[model samples]
Target: MPRRVAMILALLLCSGCSSELRNIELQRVAKDWSLVIRASQIIPVYPLTEDLQPGDTFLVQRPIDKQHELYDERGFLPLENLIHRVNPRGYQAFYENSLGLGGDAQPIPKRWLTNQQPWTQAPIASFPTYSFSVRSGSGFSLALPVQGVPIGLSLLGSDAAQGTITIADARTYGVDTVSLAKDVEDWAAQQRGFLRNYASTGAHPNYLRVVSRVYLAGRLNVSLQSSDSSGATASGGAPKPVELVTTAGGPGPQDASLEAYKSNLAKLNELIEKSLEKTPTGSGQALLPGGTVKVVAASARAISLVETFSRPLVVGYLGFDMLIGPGGTLGPPIPTYAVLTAQLEPHPATVALELLDTAGLRHTYEVLTKLGRRGDTRAADLVKQLDGLGTLVPRQYPCNMFHFGDAAGPLSIQHPAGTALPDQKGFVRITLYLGKLQSSIDDLERAQADKSLKIATFDTRDAAVDAYLAGELAASRTALRDMYRSLQAHGDLLAQAQEHATQATRKLLLE
Candidate 1:
């Protein structure tokens, strides 16, 4: 295994540093997805450039607001720059390396190194401002240079195939080649390892961490060109020569389209309320009110009712397993599973305002539910403001339905047996009958086919005599051999499968 890993690494290195690399150009791929890169150093200035204060909060990627969107002018830092690329381990190393300047280096503030913040709160910036004076230092200033040497390569592809890299300027008291090389090499190794693993798993190798998709494809060109302005474009315009190996994976979609699912989920909320308050027909499972319900259908018809009717029903959770036949026929409709575990309840704070005003209670509940369901905390203040209006108003209602996402697996249950709704009974019975008959027919067909083959084969002792018996003898011997081999193979496979099952069971039990 070690040898194989080494061989793989060697091959990767060869490809990474081949003579073909000289022509490879530094290119930037445009993507809707964001990329983050982190920095390896922070140099302090005698006086801060923008604002030099004692303690002013600075963060990247503040909490998302109610609309499932970032607050205005606020965004998660793109993975494009070094500051966003560095990981925690990298940060620790950078800090330690920077501090290694001994007595010559200024000490970093302790608070900046701590992870003491809420999950929703952003990480504190490496650089912060203080409003007041310090004991020895009245004010200190620092600025991230707009021109600093880039220590990393950006993978690019296709039409956006070529681009240039430039250094961002900042104070350089803390910059060192050794420190930068170590950080950049470590980051490059990480990216390469990840790409290799992704390739081995049949995934697109160019998919960056967090982006979950490839921004570029094929070979890239890298070169160096100088801009007319020496100070502004000296290091950059001339693209540094480098090579990158990218891989592609099978086209796979996101786990689920959250946006599309959310709309249908909202409609189901009303249906859930209606079902909970009343009794269902036969199954006695509390079903949402005023929607057409039907039994499992055989084949494609089953897939349809599930995909279509699911929108009207407000079960806490639902899974629509669609089976398409040879030519896209919907097969074997199964409700799989549907249940109402938690409904989105109105925030008491938001509802309280409605009681005081009465006119907007319904609208307030609706809006608050929408905001809460999307992980938007921006609504918190609005909800709190409403609650403060009066003590007489109710503060909570059933609106935040978290159970919808929490449900696991397909909802597999066929219930409310027999007939209940007389008006709809005939059609329900017919659909049920067809489904049952189709399933039965398929089963019978399989059994008959099995029996037919069994009868056609039997043990034959004769060889030349078996040759005289010819085709029948050959078939008999072949069947027996196949059966014996199958039994032996099954035992080995079963043993291996049992071992895996045992380990999984232990993990679950221990956890």
Candidate 2:
């Protein structure tokens, strides 16, 4: 019983990248203005808390010695490795600006910034910083106790604005970025050649840009003020005027069809929800130390193709397999199992079935059908003999998960095979279906088909065989068709969402 597997190495829902405007306006200061990017008085601090006061200065920098490189992008890099500190007089100006006093604790609720995420926390996942003070509370600062890292910073300069610095929050790589610059000049120049190309091209074409081996991802833009002889800015002075950028929605031609599509999609989701409600739910225990990781890859199929078994199994007893299979080489019409992801509802009981999908599945079925009809009627006996070989024939196969976390990297996401009928009819039927499916898949691969389609499901659901066992071909046929329909119903779910999003994006574009 080979189970389908989907693998992801990082966070979920990262559907490509796009540039976004940060709300953070730097240098909006009154006293002792060094033009720092502090927590905003208009909005609560990330990981919003009381002890960690508002207006906490965000001092982002790498260690005194490290340089930007791929090795430095590790997300688990300690917060202390980077810098997150508030000044001694961090909130002095903010207090007077607001209806408050110096050092008086003010929790950010309605009285504070309660807007959407104003800025992205690039290269850094939002982590809690504990509050502490020194020098009798003058240099009170928020200390990064754990769970965040600062990658390198980007510098954008204009001939118009100098001697004015700023920093905005953003997320890139959904992990840490560490580029240690000796000074501001050094930082902005970390990837100057590539960064310049980034702005000129206005397209971050790839998921990564290798700058001195530091994998720069998306949404990273930091500004620099005037620097001194030492290539650093003075800590004290009247901060220069900060730059401003406004957010606006661009106009688009009316797309009533897209709007209608959205409305229909909403209804489809409702229908899917009701249908999925009848499917059994399943979960796998993550190995100790690290729990199950989240899935991020977007898949296309709704129905499951793997047969469920009562027997337990550890997927990837072999090696880590990827979710996305071969490209045009495998041909058009992605494998149904490949399109069927864990993220889908009623997670059909989920990868790239490379040899399994493209070669093995087809060949296995072809040989089986040929044998079964070889006049010797040896097909049934051959399959029974294989199935009879105990675990060697394998009702279930072991597989690996895509690993990235510190936890036990080998956590299995599938349940073991359950009870099976003595007759092996379910297994026999699956081979025949797979045999038929292999030809279609091969034909598509050879044609390099542009569209995906499914005619038969290879899911070996043992319970359904009860209908066949009772000599009810019509009932079995109906059951098979229902499963296929269910698979389509579920699989179309991803399509509906992608369609709605794609169309809605037409609105986001500034006409």
Candidate 3:
């Protein structure tokens, strides 16, 4: 007897007659095999949203203007090309003068600084750098090695003798220093712009200014120092200063005057212990990498949309933007955004095969059995069927849909069905250069008081290596140039480093 078929009766109910059932059936095949899938990351773009909501969900689908005319503003390919060139990172600076100002001050952590260079050894760490500060009449200026990047500085201060402090240079000290806290806020705003504008493509803004302020010296006065255009003596261009104190806050960190410590140091110890638990680094995790993944063109949008929906089970049909390299023993680096990743979570194909008989889908059932019939000897053919089946439909439908997987590109479907797909001519995946995040967080926690100092140190070192790679001649030349600049002025350094790293890494692109 011939093999029997399995049937599924799907029913629809109505008001009058008894519900009619459509009995759908599929033939039973002799052999069976399972399937598996893997994909790296699928960043979604706005084209996927058919409808818009309010709030975060609405913002997710909100249409971004295509007006930037990347090709016009910066020729299409060059702007696209420059994106891979910039590797941006941000560091926060916290300092104090004899006046005793206490609070946190972060640089503008703009989005442009988020891209990871193809050559960057590891993904960017999302955490902020913590530091301490000390200010006096003749302020101290000390520069340290940052992974060797040339970093500039901006000081937020207030003098006790002077009623109010003033910050004159908006270029180094951003434009919006209306308030002490404004610096932090404006910095964040700039970061968002970098993510949305410059980093995605090569649309470089004219300038990135620092936000700054001046506090009157007393309990906690702080102010920004102005840089001289001529690059002369400290006093020739120097602004008058005030008192100072700088420290990375300690466990159970608490502020007290000498008078508070006149008698017992025991109470001070307990207070310090309490503060440790509340410090930013107390939990031992860093901030998530901050940046945006933009899909500028229609083709980029379609690719991202398809891959996102086909995730887990549909590895062959994705366009992954980034992948965190596996760690030595600690697992993969913590991804900047989990939901936006392409890493296979629950393999979809394998799951679908496990439910072959239970799925009640004829096409799925047929695919499973056909590849299993010839056993192990024909495994290669089966693998091709499971993976690169460019054309499998019957002669009657000669120009039907075809599927192809690209471990290096996007998994895509094409038709003799081409209109809906994006133009592949200018297609390229631009990966930014961001060095691996620091290996440990212990140092960051310890240097919390000198927030600006520590960040500046890292920027100086990172930029130095970047400058050397960019062919800036001497290492000392790069270091000296960085000495005069502050971490607050490192936008160009990060961008240049990214450019070099991307060029070096492109040689490793998958075939």
Candidate 4:
């Protein structure tokens, strides 16, 4: 038998026990349901920024009057300028210095450095913001500037393609040495590695954290597009390409050594690669880059990139922000997790009424019997009138049922059994039930003044309400039934009270 049924049977068999014992048993059963309901409602918390120090526990509390929707925002830093093209002589010097092997690598003069710059800086200021919309299981367009060059973009949810990154515009701006398409694909793969590591070592396994990190990290220069267009674009005309310049003086022992520059460049590349590899990928197949970059005029620098995810996101906001470190280098990207609560339509009034009836029926019956035993006919009739009030009240259930976003699993139990009304209505019903029950108990107290009797009655009602709020309708229902059975077992006490009242009536008649 289910534990619920077993507990019911045990309570019925022990009906002859004192009311105190029955209340204790009912509380025990109510606790079991409370645990389950509480577990389902718990939402895990995550760090919003990478700079969170140890021993800090962030907890978000709900409003006392109303509920608010949750929004999650994560920021992704851009890649720092690192890779630079070099001639055979410059390459040899960089290679030897990087490996720490002593060799006479001739340093290219500062005059040559100005003309032979490897990477051209794209004017990022031209496009300050890109407006885009992403629907669940749909694709959207994105336009962003990389190294100051504008690149057009498109994105598809996981429903379309899995783990694929396709680049549309691939023009070489400066010396045209690095493959932008190949680098993007490699970067996607590295991001997938980061996700895998987080899943393995994160304090808690959160799907939102994994999905958001990968999606934000894969695309560079992402930012939430604003609905309004004001201030969206920079005031200046198209930004001109800027050349990479080193501040080091002319070539000499006093000048900045080529060996030192190469070593620093290698370190920057290593750090960038490490950051890329640790970022997570979108849900779907692993991302593979295979598209070609279209080299067009510098004026027509539009690259349309398409990325497909595994699942659709109802993204209220999607975009990236730049965090520039010292020397204009991008800082490390941090993971962010968002918790959303969806508003659901109210359930039928019958659902809540059914729960109230199931949990309150026994209590109702007990109150009626006690009133009858105490010879309080008026109180008994008033208590009986409450039975029809359910019909007079509105049938709409009021509590707002909530669930997490698509990343998390669906809500545990939409509506628990026993007419689980929303919080407000449930509390109202509990108050009415307690009021009527207390009226009968008060009359009994005036007649006999038994403290134990009042304690037993209050204890049972309190336990039932506690169970109901926790979504343990069945337990609350059973608790009420136990209270009824305890009252029925008090037949001898009721008989004595009735006889006393009858004798008093006879004495009044004789007078």
Candidate 5:
């Protein structure tokens, strides 16, 4: 009887232990659920390459520019080609400087420089090279002539102790003749002209002279050392002084004068336009000039624009379709491109998101599914319909099927009808949103994990349970808001997709 009583006691103890374990499990689950809810409140969204706000005006260049003269004509020549040629050189230099690489060395981060087409590796060939030096004095002066014209004169690298540099437009200064002599004689003649002008007029006028000066911090007893015209000492005993080297002609074709160069460019453009006019319109075959034609035209335009206006004109290449409908009932794709140059202003409603790869989208869909299972009915319904989102659209040029977000699979819109042409615009826009959603979902899961650890420290089961329940309530509110936002974004994507499909069908019929 005593042994039987002991066995009963043992059984009772085991049962109590089992109950405690079950309670602990329940508390853990509650805490985890609460953490997940809190995490859902803040989802990390992808940032845009160029952040934009409302009322921003950005310059966009697209291949959609019609080949027809009626649609292509403009008062000012498009500097697209010139910008392309010159910008690459400037970009190379800027990037090299940024990476601390010197003199045509490749950057360490080569991936950033890689593009669909191989980059041209040739160096700039036509610019004139120059070198100069200054002696220790109150000021100094130098003049460089290119093609018989003094294009630039400055005191850019002069030292205060070495004085300043003065420039006199020889023609305006009543000095009609500039000696091409290779010695200090030419410099002496310039100095005499300056003296004669000063003696004749009490003050120099803007058209006559341009002078720059820098004051020294401390006075020094020094005399002007005799040197050759090259700013090098005749004695040749002193250490070689640092020389300031500059190049003229920039990255494009050279001319005797900027004005002449501009005139030549205008003529060239007129000729090209005339040639294009002769071609059959709407043939999709606009005649581009041969032998670096685009490069020459682009460089000329870019140089002229910058020199004349001092404002940069940004340009880029874009590819998209222009669809026309029979009754004009068809909707056009959003008149926006992936690349934009805009003057931005603050607008809370404007947001841009990018998903560079596929994995990001899949992760987003998984998170949405989790949220759906956790009592988000809207999310649940949307998730169910995601698979049937987009229809395949046919392309005319290359003649192949195009899929949206296929790179980021499963969550991507599967082409609904085999006969239907994919809406390229819808495909691109929806793909972008899918990437954004995926990124946010991934963030939610990470946040939940972090919160779970904090809730785990509760010593009492009742305390854990209370915290978990409180977390759930807070999370539920946020989840509901997120669900609505997701639905809205998805709805827009669907609407655009339908519009794109309709446009495609109309375009095919018209064709």
Candidate 6:
């Protein structure tokens, strides 16, 4: 095993040194279904397909927000400059990596890519501001330049012919590797003998880390299908076909698209809600427009629904993010695993506003919680501003009904039983924890409902919201506590996974 690790490192480390390399593939990584270089040989011949010299308006093909179609920008990666050339078509010609959906289903034209527009008008520079932690590769692209590096450990030969992707979620989302070099030093301390030798740890992780930022941040496989009736597929799936990969990815998609599921989820939710709110519909299905929606039978508080589109609406198979390592083979992807876990931390000032906007209430909550904790005796004039500090208005939209990507697996055969989600649900307890959280939510709602009658000053529940700022401010502490505990748990899980991988690899070698 040690010898093999060394061999892999030696082959990749010889940057200017030539060693025979097998057929290699280049890939583009992003969140949604974007473009990628399919399996191909990575030949280093100049001017492969197009003469896209640096600054020659080369559509390197990636995304970025602010008039950019998908917040992806690939110009920073100068493949043309790096290698003289090889087969240029694969590099220059980007193909639909996803099972074509809402967007286009063709190879993005050079013009289309060069003139990509943002989802909204005006460059939303606000996005690029946030510094990312290594929870998943969120701001990894930004993190790369510091190291002069999706960290391409994300694309191209970051895999060689090496197509391997387990999402490499190292579980440790705590330590921010803003100065990933420092992160390497720190990680070096924790690593065992063979890997500790950063001097030869496969060039200390290659560039795929960049492409992964583009292709995968977390989780897998979101399939969209509808069913006005059953025969959606020949399999005649189990009761609730769409089980949720409730782990890995973000807290699911948060936008208008989710509202489409609400009505259908409502049909099922009503059944559960109606049965005194503790009911299960005996694995019921709601025949709604465009599809047959069903709730995987579970207790009322822990609801997950799936909508099978009437027709098989597969935009594209995720195809795959193949990363062939040295010697043109496959195994648990090494080197990059550490790279994936560690992320560069962004400036708080940069991210605080953005996080507060689309992502987290934690940023806003932090200020209030701090004030509440310190119990600062400020000058009297500021008391009014302090009082309303706790009224955090979360992005209000679908209060319920979420689409947890798609059930990940060999077509998660019918969730007639709440069967599949992801191979590894973060912390194992995240799903269970949701139930406890729901209980807390239920308790809060009940308490608020009971107290509704006493407050007559303001019609909306308990007086004007300003009246509860102090109380809300105090609540931030609890909210922060939950977020902290959750993050900590994920960190611990990552450690365990790392150790487990080591042991398993050793076992495999022995066998």
Question: Can you give the TM-score per candidate against the true fold?
Answer: 0.15, 0.19, 0.15, 0.20, 0.18, 0.16
Instruction: List per-prediction Cα lDDT, in the order shown.
Output: 0.23, 0.23, 0.20, 0.27, 0.26, 0.24
Best by TM-score: 4
Residue range 329-441, candidate 6, lDDT tens digits = 11111222222222221111211111211112222233333443455333121223323332221222112211212322111112111323333322222323333333333
lDDT string, candidate 4, 193-215, tens digits = 33333221112221211111111
1-511, model 1: which lDDT tens digit per residue? 3343343334323322233332231111110001111011111121112212111111112111221232111212222211223212222344454334212232322232232421112122221111111010000100111111111111111111112221111111122323433333334322332323322111111111111001110111112122221111112221222222212233554323454344333443333234334543476544332222211111111111111111111111111111211111111112211100112211112211112111223234345435545664644444443333332211221111011111231111121223231222311222233233233323323323333322112332234423423332233233322322232233333233223334544655798
lDDT of 5 by residue, 146-243 (tens): 10010011111112112111111100000011111111121222233232222211121111110010010001111121232222111111111111
The better-scoring model by TM-score among 1 and 2 is: 2
**Model 1 segments beyond 4 Å from truth?**
1-217, 222-425, 441-511
- Lowest lDDT sum, 10 consecutive residues, model 3, at 25-34
Worst 10 residues of 6 by lDDT: 167-176
Q: Model 4: residues >4 Å from true position, as ranges?
A: 1-66, 69-303, 310-359, 372-378, 382-511
Worst 10-residue stretch by lDDT in candidate 5? 168-177
Task: Put down candidate 3 lDDT per residue, 1-511, tens digits, no spaces.
Answer: 0111000000001111222211110000000000101111221111112111100000111111221232122211111111211111222222223212223332221221232321121112111121222122122221111100000111112111111111111111111112322322222222333333322122211111111211110011122232232221111111112111223335553534443333223342233223222323456633322111111111100111000111011001111111111110001111212312323331111112111111122223233334335352333343333232212211221221222233221212233322232221110100000000010111222233232332321344355534432331122222222221222133233233333334433533643
lDDT of 2 by residue, 379-488 (tens): 44544443432222223211111111223212111222232313344334444433333332233232222122211221342444333222322222233333233323
| TM-score of decoy 5 | 0.18
**Residue 145, model 6: Cα distance from true site in angstroms:** 31
Please tell me which predicted candidate would have the highest lDDT against the true structure: 4
- Cα RMSDs, all models: 36.4, 30.9, 33.4, 32.3, 37.5, 30.5
- lDDT winner between candidates 4 and 6: 4
Candidate 1 residue 37 Cα shift, in angstroms, is: 20
